[model samples]
Target: MGRRSLSGKVVVITGGARGIGAATARALASRGAVVVIGDLDVEPAKETAAAVGGSGHALDVTDHAAFSAFLGSLGQIDVLINNAGIMPLAAVTEEPPETTARQLEINLHAVIHGTRAAVGIMRRQGSGHIVNVASAAGKFGFPNGSTYCATKFGVVGFSEAVRAELRGSGIEVSCVMPGMVRTELISGLSEIGFLRPVTAEAVALGIVRALEKPRFDVFVPRRLNALTRFQRLVPRRLSEWAMRVVGADTALFHGASSAARAAYETRVHG
Candidate 1:
């Protein structure tokens, strides 16, 4: 299919202050999309938006009323990217209840709320796209990241069901599953063989491609899609062995105590 033009499209991105969200905002703007950034960090979000000739707003995605108001303020919504999330690594048993709740609220519930709001607007217009940023951990569980993995897994499943629901409504839904990305989210984490960390720009490009082509599943580095498919068909024991070989089993566990991750961990924990 021919690529769709992003020119003049009004795209709304949550968590656009940094990382993949900021990268995507710049990329879509380069394609002539009028990007609107919404982040908890209003100052940085505005800075990013100013650089791209877009606009920024204070958005707390976890609050339904605030999220709805933020979207409603936008005149037209061509695309909505639910990108706000936090990852606080810890063993499932050792994880605090507050930490688990925070992850669920930010990572999964917020996506759900934003998607539903976008659907209402898109249904009225009869055209739109929703991109949910999940993770490769959503496809396979890893040590010391059980809650984080659960939230991502929920995003993957939720996106699939919503995609099916919106099949003929002219509103496309994409689930982005990226491997360990070179962002603060993966600070202090070591690369696991060939599953090395991908750049935030690379993930942003995958999102851009999804917008242009309207694909349902978007995997950064692209190879992860195939690997995940293979993992699904293999025996459980074999898949477990493969994970061990690639160091996925202990990457997050070791990263938890790394001094490099202290600041990011502190921010997320608070």
Candidate 2:
């Protein structure tokens, strides 16, 4: 199939002030897409947008009304990337109820709402794409990140159902599952053997490639897709064993105590 041109496409991204979202904005802009960023930190968002020659707005993804208003204000959205998410890792038994609720709101509910809003607008325009950024945790459970895993799992399922519903509607849906990314989100995370964290720009490029060639499941490193598929074919016990051998079991727990994560944890939890 011929590659689709992104030139002049109006792309909207949430949580685009930094990390993967910001990287995606810059990448898409370089491809000639008109990128607009919405983030809670509006100043950095504006700066990111300015660097891409796009507009920026303050958006709290949890607020449905505000999110809707923000998208409505943008004349036409050819692509909506539901990239706003938070990861506050903790054991399910020790995780705070508030943290669970926040994760559900930001990681799952916001994606749902953004996709719904974009669908309505895109239906009228008759062409659009929605990218929901999930995580590798969505596919495999990890210690000290039960709730975070749940929310991402929800995103993956939700995106799948929506993609089915939007078929033949000229609206493409993509679910992005990236492994541990080298960002503030993993500030204190220890490296896992063979599963070392990837750069945000790598994930950004994955998103860009997905846009250029519409695919349902987008794995950042690409090899992860094969690994995940192979995981399902193995016995559950074997899968668990592999997880342990890779140190995926205690990475988050160790990160929870790391002083390097203090600032990020405080900002998210507070």
Candidate 3:
């Protein structure tokens, strides 16, 4: 495949009403890509789209047919950013089963549905890019984010397989692993000494870079890839001790305040 410019390309971004998704929409739109924002928050999506001189629509990623229909309405697409995800932090035993299930449905299953909807169109066009946003937890597990980690790990693995399967077909797949972006998902959480969250704008740049370079995986901050690979080489006991030393072991629990938990519960149940 040849290197392509984003200018004038039609790009669709899921969950584009806020955070990294919204940032990506703004960045890509500025680069001349025709951006389309989709989210359950229809009004905000429209507002975001209007701000970027794009368009917005309501989309429930869990519904497979809705995903396909939205993609079909676009006619032709140059890129699809599977950016819709939710992170509700809780200890495995203390968390509600329904909440965990909902997290998986949104973070993992929705990405799958979005990819399935876009892959066919891209394959037929013989040119496109698919960017899936995974997290640092996707590469390594933490105490309070088991379910979120599971979903992201699934995304990493899924991206690898799909990239290989689509090799030489002109459709490229990129997995973006970002560490602690300052997004709404972690909003209201107390700032920790060790964890410095980057801006959503930074991660958005990483996504755009991945699309231009067509790499299988792009880690925001770049150094995160080193940490992710190093974790795998060390023994489990040492890794656990390292996590404790860095205060990652308790970061999620301490950060997930009662209000945050309640907010998630209200969103999922109501």
Candidate 4:
């Protein structure tokens, strides 16, 4: 229940090659944890792990057997961070079914796979922590991102229910909801003044803080939670209008990749 130290701890992170995952690896390593980065990009994973004086492996979180095997290879795991995700934006009706499925697989299914593996190790040891890197979209849905929202919302729900189920098991589960962070995932977008993405390092700090002081929910900026909750309290119409005025609806739309647009077109017209 009190603060915990990372010294000599064993931490495993999915999608740790870059972005928030890479930053979090560095943060945990600095705290004396032995970090292991798992990512599809083998070279980058090795590079990141080396930078943090840890180890890296090529991992596809979607592969249940592989995920389980990776954890089994490690003698013990003190912490597991489910940070792998993909965001493909398109109108609900226009979204490609394949893309939607991939989104759900990565953002939601992967968490379940990784958590199951980690919980097994943690339960046997009687002490562990799991950090799920969900997005603010998990809390509040935005237009043109129905599938992404669905996957993240699923994560939020899964994290809460599991945290409650794991009570007194010496395992803590924390759901991290970050508004926006500067990452390659959204590199095409121009920064909006109010919805500007926080640095990946800042989000990493929040993750480490959550680890030390276990909490069910963690917001990167901390204050973003208030705004998100307030939006839910207000009238639906007001919330919709507020989001539009703040450019939330068009945020990812404007920066959508060419491939995304083409997928939507091909799926709809074909």
| TM-score, structure 4 vs. true | 0.93
Q: Give candidate 1's whole-model lDDT.
A: 0.92
lDDT of 4 by residue, 9-128 (tens): 999999999999999999999999999999988899999999999999999887899999999999899999999887766788887778888888889999988998899999999999
Task: For candidate 3, report its TM-score.
Answer: 0.94
* Cα lDDT tens digits for candidate 1, 1-270: 899999999999999999999999999999999999999999999999999999998988888999998898886999999999999988888889999999999999999999999899999999999999999988989888999999999999999999999888899999999998999998887776867889999999999999999898899879988889879899999988988887888878766788888788888876
Ranking by lDDT: 1, 2, 4, 3
How many residue pairs clash in model 3?
0
- Model 2: per-residue lDDT, tens digit, 14-96? 99999999999999999999999999989999999999999989999999999998898887999999998888877788888
- Per-model TM values vs. the true structure: 0.98, 0.98, 0.94, 0.93
Name the lDDT of candidate 2.
Answer: 0.91
Write down the worst ten-residue block by lDDT for model 3.
261-270
RMSD for all candidates, in order, please: 0.9, 1.0, 1.7, 3.3
- Residue-pair clash count for candidate 4: 0
The candidate scoring highest on lDDT is: 1
Better candidate number, 2 or 3, judged by lDDT? 2
Regions of candidate 3 where Cα sits further than 4 Å from its true position: 1-3, 258-261, 268-270
| Local lDDT at 103 for model 2 | 86
